[model samples]
Target: MNVRPTLEEIRRAPKVLLHDHLDGGVRPGTVADLARESGYPDLPTTDADNLREWFEAAADSGSLERYLETFSHTVGVMQSVEALTRVAYECAEDLANDGIVYAEVRYAPEQHLRDGLSLEQVVEAVLDGFERGGREFGIRVGTLVTAMRHQARSMEIAELAVRYRDAGVVGFDIAGAEAGYPPTRHLDAFEYLQRENAHFTIHAGEGFGLPSIWQAIQWCGADRLGHGVRIIDDIKVDGDRARLGRLADYVRDKRIPLEMCPTSNVQTGAAKSIAEHPIGLLRRLSFRVTVNTDNRLMSGTSLSEEFAKLVEVFGYGWDDLQWFTVNAMKSAFAPFTDRLELINGVIKPGFAQLKWSGTRPLA
Candidate 1:
């Protein structure tokens, strides 16, 4: 009889996350605690459960702009160095407990500067937290310093990323609403990273269309596409046959990793539902697709939950899960040697064990 993997099995399989946001993934209790400590007065609720519900409800508005508005409270409480460090540490701990072996968690350093902490201080605090969490939990955590695209400090943030490349920071990124604030506006940042031979990803094709992705790649040279969910707009599938547009062809041909966040995409109206998400088709077409949790708190998801949903919706099994996990590790901004080490030494063996011990039925 054909059986599916259980949720516990899914949690035991080593996973890699390439596109998680630090600010957006804070725990609800932590958010309330931070708010109380910082004396931030704007939180809608002090009860942790209610606060979590508010975040999820606020992000369910179907407008990307409205969805992003929920971050103001998260970012608000994260202004101090102590708060940033604690959040980063907790992010690593949470992901490790959720069976994530490696993750690239991102946050905008500029947004955390409201309390007079310098950019360097912000990076150091986060790195300290991640290092602490990694050591305690026996997991690997890397940071991606992001710049807000609507703002004019992308070049500065790019420089910050390069400055800390050998430190804990692994990559650079520009994230914000994708309409009026196109990625081309941040070309200088991408160019600077390229000149320095640093890695970076762009939040494209999520709230925008192909042009955003084109500029992010052809013009800006992104290492990965953050939430490149809109690539489906350029693809047409006909039963067993499929057609790809020029952009889609290039993306697939180049093996550009699409950091797909299914639940978050549905919450933001990027995809209609879990079953209708483009991830299933993209994975079938063999695009370098990787599942991620763009925002854990806002979307109420984890790496295991993301994989479980795919298994239930698309009938994905252990092999499919391993493929996505390996794809993410390969596309991680960490050094190639480190990625290979984890893939061969940790991820493959972990999934292999789960497949071999297939006693528990899928839930």
Candidate 2:
């Protein structure tokens, strides 16, 4: 039988988050404060605790349409450049506190343009905020310019991301309902990003199926998959053994990372529950699986909380968490040198302390 590590031990483990949404991870109090500053008074709940519960319940409704409605409330207040900057800064500070050595926070610029903020202005403001927070908290953060899949401006958003590639924007992505608005629909955008030699991750198989996952990788040329928990559906498990499909074989062989968010997957109905998630199976199969909190406020989780849940459900130990953290660092779009620096400087030392504590390493 596998042994579950204590919460204290898991909390001390180093972590990397490759898939987090900036607006989705906003603190409820920050949203309330921003709402007050912006004079937007239509929030379902005014109190921070109540507002958080409200977001979680809405997102857990099992309907992607209703789940997306919660974002409108959070993004509604994040209109002005000041609001964006503050929220972005707070996200970095919070992630650092969660012990995430490296993270890539994604947000759609078009969603933040309702208040007359240009795409360029929004990108610059967010970068400024991340830089300030990084200096204050001493964590490495990058931005992934996201384009909404249902929207027709994906090509434009992709270009904007590549245009600002050197200005803190690390990659590109397409998020939103993944069923009808498939990645194939945004081929132009993906094609443009490829031509510019830019990297991108796609949201697939969260609310959809293997076809969505296939198209995102085979058709759209994605470097990583966002909420790709459904890739497990392609694997044929026979008792203690499992077989992989052609697509799964390709993904595993190429080491295309799958950004799996456990709590969020359960809350969003992607996974039935934490115990049922395929993270452990995928990890054992050597699929470059990295854990993340898709939305902290909505899932009521941090990186530590995620690590803790994995321990409770799958009996993960310090070594398992370390492997996941390193997988995330390897999957990050950060430059090779920067990635190595984080691994050597932050991740290695943190795990070394844990190893020296005499916890039995996973065999």
Candidate 3:
């Protein structure tokens, strides 16, 4: 009988994060420093605290396109190899401090080429950072190389992913506005990845609708759905019972992981409010729902904070937290042996310690 976990207890619990963005979680102070070093003048403010507030406020727009616009500043400062490596290192450290035992942070290589670094150079820089940071922080970090959906380089990026698959890069992704750039537009890339036998997740159903999700899974063959909150559109609820439509049923039956980033969904108007987020219904339906932080700096959140919000809004207990963590771990791009080791060795024991702190006769 695991009661609701306190924020402190939750902070200490091992968590798995899958949807976090690399450029989206930069430390504010580092952004300022990198901007100064890189001579990028686009930052709204050099003061770290003010910059943090600016990112959060700017990203609160109810449009995913506008929300993505905030990334320009963060990505602006991360250009050179040193800048990218430092950002990746700090990202690993931040996640570790927040008790995220394992995470897959994503970034677009094309977005980092403004300063003349090649795609391989960009990947190497980030990999170096994650490797060093993981070693220092005692956390496992994997990278997902992303291509901008609106761009025509998905195949290039997909090849890059495979070229470095055995390296720290674990998967591939396509991000940016999901409106005009459906996953099917990159069918060639997805097919290439499949032939290479590489894993990948797609940014679907966050800024778009059920059609977008359908294309990502059925057409593009994504191993996981990023911000799949929109799948609720296919689910009809009547009183305490619910009927899942064909697509929803298919998703659930296939156990396709839905990386649900509640705060980011609410910020981007994908979900109206945290209390009413589809994760509640999706979780109840056992839709392979997993919690995440799409952008920690933009959302002013960490994995623990995201769990805390669910605990506050949905009355999620330690059991629910453990379930989400395990779902994310199982859904991770990490090797099955690695994922199993963490789930059994770290996640389960961590939650047990928190929820079963003491023994007394319950009356």
Candidate 4:
């Protein structure tokens, strides 16, 4: 007989995160404190608990646009160098405490320039914070500098990513509403990154359909798909048999990583519910499916919480959790040697203990 793993057990599992956002995962209390120090009085509530509830409720409006509105408050407070560094440092500490041994946190450098900070300064501050936090928390953190798809600074952001490639910055990304602002609009950035042999992922297939995903992959050549929940649209299930569309076949055949954020997908209406998410089918089909928390604060989730929910809904066990963790580590933008080191040294060893403990069955 197999027993369900406890929350504490799940929390102790070594995890790898590849799709977290720095601005969207700010601590609620930190938001209030930053707002007060910045003299920004537009917060709905200064009470940390109330603010948290507000963010979750606001993000649950079942519309991606409305869901994104919650970021205004968070991004508003992250203009200065001190605020950016604090948010990044705390992000590392929080994920480390959540048992995430490695994470690649993304944020738009352009969004934090309101206080007249240069793009270089914005990147430097975040890298410094991640360095400090990683040293203190014993967690490895990599930064991905993102560009807003709705805006036209992607090329510039890509340059910044390359400039800091030897630093803490790992990759470039284009993230925003996927409907009107297609990934093709930022071809210059993707082309630039490709020319320089840099890595990049595009936000696609979440709020949009197969076309969005098709363009991101075939057109923009994304290294991974961010919140690619709509990849389900390209897969048709007939009883026990499943058929994949051309795009879906290509995605699966190529083993492109889908950074699926189950809770955040539901909050943004990309997924109807956790039980009905495409990740289950995708995983079973051997797609390169990696679990993530697109926005922890808004979704009120951590990587551990994400795995725990999957366990409850899909009856996942140590083997399943290890699969997703290894997928993420393999798909990470870091060097192949680094990825291999973490997989063998940290992730596998950590899960091996849990596996032999008889907490749950492999299946």
TM-score of each: 0.98, 0.96, 0.98, 0.98
Worst-scoring 10-residue span by lDDT in model 1: 1-10
Predicted structure 3: lDDT: 0.93
lDDT of 3 by residue, 108-151 (tens): 99999997999999999999999999999999999999999999
What is the overall TM-score of model 3 with all chains considered together? Answer: 0.98
Candidate 2, after superposition: displacement of residue 164 in Å?
1.1
lDDT of 1 by residue, 1-363 (tens): 235776777888899999999999999999999999989999999999999999999998878999999999999999998999899999989999999999999999999988899999999999999999999998899999999998999999999999999988999999989999999898888888999999999999998888999999999999899999999988998989889999999999999999999999998888999999999999999999999999999999998999999999999889899999999999999999999999999999998888877764555
Per-residue error at 167 for model 2, in Å? Answer: 1.3
lDDT of candidate 4 over 23-142, digit per residue (tens): 999999999999999998899999999999999999988899999999999999999999999999999999999999999999999999888999999999999889999999999999
Please report, in order, the local distance difference test score of every candidate based on alpha carbons.
0.93, 0.88, 0.93, 0.93
Query: In model 2, which regions exceed 4 Å deviation?
Result: 1-4, 358-363
Model 2, position 208: C-alpha lDDT score: 94
Query: Residue-wise lDDT of candidate 2 within 89-119, one digit each (tens)?
Result: 9999999887777889999999999889999
Candidate 4 C-alpha error for residue 65, in Å = 0.4
**Residue 281 in model 3: lDDT:** 93
